[model samples]
Target: MERAKPSSIKRATALRYMGASGWQPDDATTALLDRAEEKILAAATPRAAVRRLPRAVFPPPELDCGTDLTRHLQGCDAVLLMAATLGSQVDSLLRRLELTDIAMAAAADALSSVLLEQICDELEAEWRAKFAAEHLYLTGRYAPGYGDCPLELNDELCLAVDTVRGCGLAITPQHLLAPRKSTTAILGIADHPVTGTLAGCTTCHLRETCSFRKQGTTCFAK
Candidate 1:
């Protein structure tokens, strides 16, 4: 009985039962879940910003690997950073006792994460167009924890973005962002034109030991 009460659940298996249960959802049920996902996204807030580096050339910061963001990110108009985490609304579904409701909640989570990534992509594209208007160039967007970028800078990026106000998401004491899958990123802008993904790869610090590089394939660097 206590297990059925819902609070004790570390995880739920709503999707797992759907195939075997032979249950059919009506329009209303589907609509309800869709609405819930919208609500979750609407409730989400994000913090983002661009910061200028100090004029004095500082010592090259140690890389999380051999990657240095400052070196790679230099000569850009600004660095775009965003931070967000799971909100209370997202937590509610996991805490529900009803099996159907729990599934809907899981649906909401899956949809929300996908939507969140979409938002980032959309915003990045829009920003690219905006910068183009002024004949500016950018290196596209890249997050802190990818390739040679240091994963540890996640905290600093969050703070720069005013994360809590912009979004309900926050990081846990251990540096894990609440909701588990939230993300942050940095975009580099160039005064002149930047090259393509293949070229970017070639110039990247990771290139020497990168899988692509290992295969003797190389990007055309500008």
Candidate 2:
């Protein structure tokens, strides 16, 4: 579900979205993204069927991330899909790309790495404001290529949320999402509450069993 923007908090919050590194937005790109965001917000979307994921983790296992993940994901009420299609990022650097539609791929990669989080942050805060509550904390996002979670599950999760029809977000066979500006993710509801920062799969001792951690950089925390 889309949430209202907290105009009073936009400036400060944008920095928060940027975090310690500070996400600086280019004027032209910011304008484009803002417009796209507006259009997306203006469009009517169906209320997604929200379920508290029995387990939540960066790399979903055959049966969901183990106990700690379940413990952490406990209080989330909905999954925020930060529409990600890195096509645009790569598109800008097309000259250096060697793949098909290199431009789109490059664009998508950059977008996925940079903008998706910020967009999701803005969306997350807005959603919180709409409910007049703050229980909607991100339970950390679980992408494909992490654990036993099949890269294929991306399709199932997106479908469960009615992503394409609802928000015009789509994923490709290569595990890339479309719209070059869209993203999809799961947010399970948590009646209880979790504290502190979100943890990456690497932090979990079970990461040895995780597919993503092996690639380096823990998903939860450094």
Candidate 3:
């Protein structure tokens, strides 16, 4: 019996999903994808949670990121701190695929990448609708590890949102997110219309070596 619904897949535009997943399937490879997808879906346990906090109180003006955070949260009254994951089962499945079947592992990995983003998207969409009812709008989400935001901030975010307690998400000392298929981000809420525009490849610190961007793909695209 299923305990939880599987995370939904977000298809990419113009074959970008294929690039994000790192595979262009041929007829031979196509036969195995259906099964691979099933494996991923069956193993995934999608979970997410959001916490609303005044931008100033949450970040503390004395904190180093406060300046940047203020800039990021400009024109907003609060920040929606979010965390989400596809659970540990997907991690085990990926490990098994790595040892027993490299091809399937690659495909599963790509799908997981898309799935996690899709989960975040769904959560954001719900928040958008909720806030829109009040005539407020959400700004584009900004995550740690993007642009000047340090991955180290993952710790603060986890603590602030109690991600481990609320959504079963954790971060290692090195700042690697646990479940290996999870994300945390900040969304701004304001009275005026706020278009959530991501920094995109141009401003990304890793733009040069980004495999997706190199292949003409971007994770920021809707």
TM-score of each: 0.55, 0.47, 0.86
lDDT of candidate model 3 versus the reference: 0.76
Q: Name the regions of candidate 2 deviating beyond 4 angstroms.
A: 1-71, 75-112, 134-138, 179-182, 195-222
RMSD of 3: 3.3
TM-score of 1: 0.55
Which wins on lDDT, candidate 2 or candidate 3? 3
What is the TM-score of candidate 3?
0.86
In model 1, the runs with Cα more than 4 Å from the true position are 1-65, 68-78, 84-86, 94-102, 165-168, 179-181, 195-222
* Candidate 1: worst-modelled 10 consecutive residues by lDDT: 1-10
The most accurate candidate by lDDT is: 3
Which runs of model 3 end up more than 4 angstroms from their true locations? 1-8, 11-24, 66-71
Tens digits of per-residue lDDT, candidate 1, 98-121, equal 356665665666555654555555
Question: lDDT of all the models against the reference?
Answer: 0.51, 0.44, 0.76
Ranking by lDDT: 3, 1, 2
Better of 2 and 3 by TM-score: 3
How big is the positional error of residue 114 in model 1, measured in Å on the Cα after superposition? 1.5
Which candidate gets the maximum TM-score versus the true structure?
3
